[model samples]
Target: MSIDLKTIKHISKLSRISVDEKRAEKLAGDLNSIFDFIEKLNELKTDNVEPLTSVAETTLKLRPDEVKSKNIREQIVKNSPQDNEDYFVVPKVIE
Candidate 1:
């Protein structure tokens, strides 16, 4: 596929980019080259190729989940300016 000046201007508008006529014409040529390369790639045969999720062969090591700290809610809540038995109180802002 070939990119024209109008298409380049449209792309610039959609991307919120400012481009002059000279730059847009240059960008149109650049985009046409990119599409031509993609079209060339599409002509290649890769029916036997397998999709790859990762290039490296490795597994993640995970540790067993366990609680390392005891309950300290009462100790921490003592520092709060306003807190109830099991919750913190804050001023309401909504009407």
Candidate 2:
């Protein structure tokens, strides 16, 4: 696959980037090189390879869900600079 000058201009327009006539021609060449590299990668054989999530095999340790701390809303809210009966209070912004 290869990119053309007209396609490069269209891409520049879509990306909202300003490209001079000379730069557009250069961009087309760069895009063509990228597509050529991708085509070369496509020729590689990976039939026996497994999709990898990480470089090494490891297990993530998980703990059983249980309540570790008792609720202390009253004690926590007692020292608040601004708080309501059950939540923090903030200055109103809208009129």
Candidate 3:
């Protein structure tokens, strides 16, 4: 399959990319070259080749979910610069 200037213009319109006449002509040539390379790849014989998914053979190790602390709210609030017993006070950031 080959790409033409008309097809490139249509593609540019669909993608919302502004393409001038000179650029569209260039795009047409570039797309045609890509398609030609793909066509050449399609001609390759790979009947016995296995489909590859990943280069590395690694498995993720998961740890059991458990809470380390039960009650530490008083200790955490003591370290704050400006603190309220219920929640930490923050400086006004938005107008």
Query: What value does the lDDT take at residue 20 in candidate 1?
Result: 100
23-43 in candidate 3: lDDT tens per residue? 998888889999999999999
Query: What value does the lDDT take at residue 46 in candidate 2?
Result: 88
Residue 74 C-alpha lDDT in model 3: 89
TM per candidate comes to 0.69, 0.71, 0.60
Q: lDDT of candidate 2? A: 0.85
TM-score between candidate 1 and the true structure: 0.69
Displacement of residue 70 (Cα, Å) in model 3 is 9.3
What is the Cα-based lDDT of residue 78 in candidate 2? Answer: 75
lDDT of 2 by residue, 2-88 (tens): 788889888889999989999988888888899999999999998999999998888899999998779888887777668667876
The candidate with the higher TM-score, 1 or 3, is 1
Decoy 2 TM-score against native: 0.71
In the order shown, the candidates' Cα RMSDs to the true structure are 2.7, 2.7, 4.6
Question: Which regions of candidate 3 are displaced past 4 Å?
Answer: 57-95
lDDT of 1 by residue, 1-95 (tens): 78898888898999999999999988988888999999999999999998778899678999999988789888877776686777767778798
Look at candidate 1 and tell me the lDDT of residue 34: 90
The order by descending TM-score is: 2, 1, 3
